[model samples]
Target: MKKAIGQILSGNMLSKALGLLREILMAKFFGTGDINGAYRIAQTGTLVPINFMTSDSLNSAFIPLYKKYLAEDEQRAAVFKYCMFLFFSVVSILIFSILYFQSEYWVKLMAPGISESAREMSVSLLKVMAVCCPFYLCSGLVNYISMAHGDYKPMSMRASAQNVGMVLGVVAAFYSGNYLYLAWGFTGSYVFFSFWVVFRAFKGEILNFPIRLETKEVKLVMSNFWITLRPLLILPLILQGNITLERALASLISIDVVSALDYARFITDTVVFILSVPIAFAGLSEWASQTPEQVREKIIKIYYWLALLVINMSFFIFLSARDIVIFLFMRGEFNEQSVMATTHIIQGMSIGLWAQVVGYIFIKALSAHLNNRKVLVVMVFSLLSNAIVNVLTYKIWGAFGLGIGNAIYGIVMFLVSAWYLKIARSLYPVIIQISAGIVIYFCVYRFIGGYFNESTSAMLRLLVNGMVFFLFAFLWAMLFPFYRQGVIKVMTRKRLR
Candidate 1:
């Protein structure tokens, strides 16, 4: 699992580096206005349901069951994959057809404040992009299959391809003054990446696309899928709802508001992609296969490690929010207002980074056990609380308030899951260690930040400050016996494996 995580994290790093470039190009070409805002709404709106069907719904249910089947009989597992592919493919086709024909309705609903001209443009672009949904569904299944086998390289490579395609599309849009190029670019990326994934699966002998409706494995898979569907669907609905609500609220403020939120989220997601997502992906199967005692032990170790990583990242980002935003986005149409807007939002978002990390750890642990009912209850409570907080605070804090509300949701989720799972006591020690580390780092940052000249390049200043901070953090972690022992244990365990 550690090896898989290392590979996935490396790929994630490359993908995020490219993703940053993609966002930079977007800001340069489209600016943080109606054009970009409309595109953002249309893009997010179109993908939300598809994500629900693929990642949140299908993959969540499919992976554990598939792992169980694979353990029993390879042939039976192959048959199950075939049935799932057929089922998902047909559903994806239907979804795409409906979305393509109803593109205008979704666009209008998702971005009501956009100009008529921009809305029409977004609808057209959305329809074109809708062509890629079935392909995404297919590719997503392939990626999930690879994940079940502990190979995340394919998924990471596909994301890199998508980022590369978007960068090319943004360049085309820049030269041609045609935003449609961006949609086509993304479609091309999905189509190509899907083909590549299938080719890789074939080489690995993991491609089993034949339909075998008569097989008992088919009946078994279908039954399990339906059983897993209900509780699994809650997470996606809440996640999609959060995005829609955030965008809706931002639109009420201004198009720039939506763009600002998007920019800030991109920064926070970079941290999540690196530190949290890889572990969740790699550990799902591992946890599922573990004994109850082993799962408890694993969760404790994993949670503290994630807490350390996320806290360091959160503090670094919070301290360097302005420099990061200016260095990455203060160009072309992304002006002073855009920089200030994005910087504030990033700081707000950073406050929740630790909570997000902890929340994800709890989510994966629960899912591993297929304890979906308890997880569902926790998710529902978190979503309701989050919505109320967002409504009450958005007026005063704007996008930053949205971040705070989300952070609060993450905290609630982690605490609730910990208490329910009877793991709350295990967190007390790590909490103290993390708190002390944070205070020490903050003081050092205050003294260190004063030394950098204001006239220096933002990127240079950030790079230098990041180096200094990491050095201090490294020393702090190494000096602590608990952290030192944890690091050695991971290294020793990996070597033994």
Candidate 2:
């Protein structure tokens, strides 16, 4: 189990590193321009449905069901695959048809604050991106087949392929001298990558697309869909509340506000991908397999350490936002103003990193227990809170207001979910660790600011400050009785030669 955890973490880390490099290149080339905003909206529109159908539903439903089928009747696995394929094919066609026909209206609705040129560009990009819907739906089914077989290597490689496609699209944009060609490049990559996964699945004999669906298989699929719908019905309202509000409100801001928010969000998500994905993949399977007492013990043991890591990293990034943005992105059309705007948004978003970690973990833990209804309820309430705050504050605060609302929503969801989990005993230690980490970070930031000019490179300042803060926090944790015991156990476990 530990080895499996290590493999998952390693794959996640590798994928994140590749994604980080891709983002750096993208920021340097595009910044927060009309073109970039159009691309972002197009990509978001393309991915939203895929995320809903596959990630949101498949992870929670398909894996468990597949496992059950394998345990009870292994031969039924083929029937399950064919049923899922048929269902996904029908759904994807319907969704894609609507999106293709409604592209213009969606462009007007999603980013009405942008110029006519930007809106038209967005519509064109959305049309191109829509081509990937069927491909993604098929690929998603292949992902489940591979995962059910206990072979995550193919899934990891396929993920890398998707990133490769993004990199190729950016390269095409850089040299093609036309955005349409770049958009086509993006569309082609998704097609190729999705087909690649399908081919691999077929080669392994783990996937078979049936020409005719079985009645019993169809009923089973419908039952699973209904079970999934119990959560899906409320999920969009709960999950998209903040995002929908952000886009709508940003549309009311300055012309560039929407683009700026997207850029900042891309950066913030990069950080989240780094921290959250590995922890989730490593922890979820382990938690799922553990006894209740064992799970509780493990959660308590790791919660404070994870909290400390998030707080320290958020502080480091917040303090170094300006340099990081300027050094990595202040080139070509991405000028000084773009850097300043993006940096401000990054700093604002950093405030919520700890909350995000807690909320994400809670969601995963809840899902493991198949308590989707409770998760949906919490998400709905969080969405409502986000919508109210974003609508009320966005006019006064601009893009930063959107960031603040996101952070607040995360903290609220974490608190609410923690209550649902009945884990108050774990919260006190986490609160103390976070408080100490924040104090240490702020004190260091002030001292560094006194000696160093603001003109210093953001990345350099962040690196130095991060090292000092981490050292202080490490020493502090080593001295505290509870943390000291954890450190001693970890060291002893490693040193048992």
Candidate 3:
């Protein structure tokens, strides 16, 4: 499991770095301009449905079922795979066709505040990007197959390929200063990497071409998918709606506001991906296989460490949001005003970043237990919270209100998870630590930041403050026996291996 985690973390780190680099290039070239906003809206519109169909919606049902078949019979597993591949492929094609034809309306619906030129441009980009939807579906199934076989390398390589394509695309767009070029680059990524992963899947025997679908196992697998789809897989669909709501609300404010919200939320997601996603990936299969009691124990331990991660990372992000934004994005067209707008959004988002990341773990655990109804209920409430808060606040706060809405949703979702899991007793200590960490981190950053001259570079100030906070936090963690034991245990296990 540690080895699997290491692989996921390394891959995620590289992928995120490249993704951030691509975003930086986009910001440098486009800033919060009309084209940039258009590009953002187009991409979001293209991806929300694709992401829903390809990611959690498929994987939540696919993984456990695939694992089950693989455990019982490889032949059965292969048959199940073929059927699903056929089903989603047809769905993907149908959806992409719809999006391709209705791109104009979708773009207008997503970003009504944009000018006619930007709206038309977004429609063109959305149509081009819609072609990638089927590829995404294929890649998702192949990746899940790799996971079931305990071969994570293919997924990592696929991610790397996609990021590379995106980076190159952004670079090309940077030179051309054309949103059309950027759209092509985005489409070209799915075109290239999907084939590459398909090749890998074939080579690894994770998938076979000319797949046979008419097998007895097909009915069983389809039934399982139906059952899983109704409850567990529906979560991502609702979450996607929440995302669309946020973007739509932001668009009503201004196109620039939409881009700013994306930037801020992207940064928050990057942090969450780095800290929580790999762990969740590594632990999920084990969690699924465990008895309820064992799962509960695992949840406690995961929650404890996750709390530590969330609190400390949120503190760092809250304190250093401006510097981070300035250092990474304050270049070329991405000017001071863009930085200021993004910084405010980040600050508001930092408030609930912890809840969001932790809630992800809770969702995964619940899914593993086949307790998807609870997850769905929480998500429904979260979406409602997000929509109401966004509507109420956006009129007054603009993009910042969107951020605030996300935070509110995150908080509500986390509370719901805690209530359902009945973790209040174990959660008390973590809450106390979070409070202490927040106060301590704030004081340390302020004290260190106070010494810096006004002319000091943002990078230097960020580094100095970050280093000081890290040292203090390290010492604090060392003083705690549980934290110390965790560190020692991991190190000892690695050394022994």
TM-score of each: 0.91, 0.91, 0.93
**Worst-scoring 10-residue span by lDDT in model 1:** 208-217
lDDT string for model 3 (1-497, tens) is 67767887888888888888888887888898888888889989988888887666467677877788779877778888888888888989987988999888888777777889888888988988898888878887788788777877666666666778778877777677666777777778778877877888788876853245565667877887788778756667777777787888877887778788878977998877777777666666667788877867777888888788777777788778889998889898898778877988898788889988888777677666667788788888987898899889998987678778888888888888777877757877876866786687677657775658758898998889788777777777677788899999999999999
Pairs clashing in candidate 1? none
Worst 10 residues of 2 by lDDT: 277-286
Error of 1 at 177 (Å): 1.2
Q: What ordering of candidates by lDDT runs from best to worst?
A: 1, 3, 2
lDDT of 1 by residue, 324-353 (tens): 988888888998878877887788777777
Better of 1 and 3 by lDDT: 1
Clashes of 1: 0
RMSD, each candidate, Å? 2.9, 2.6, 2.5
In terms of lDDT, model 1 sits at 0.80
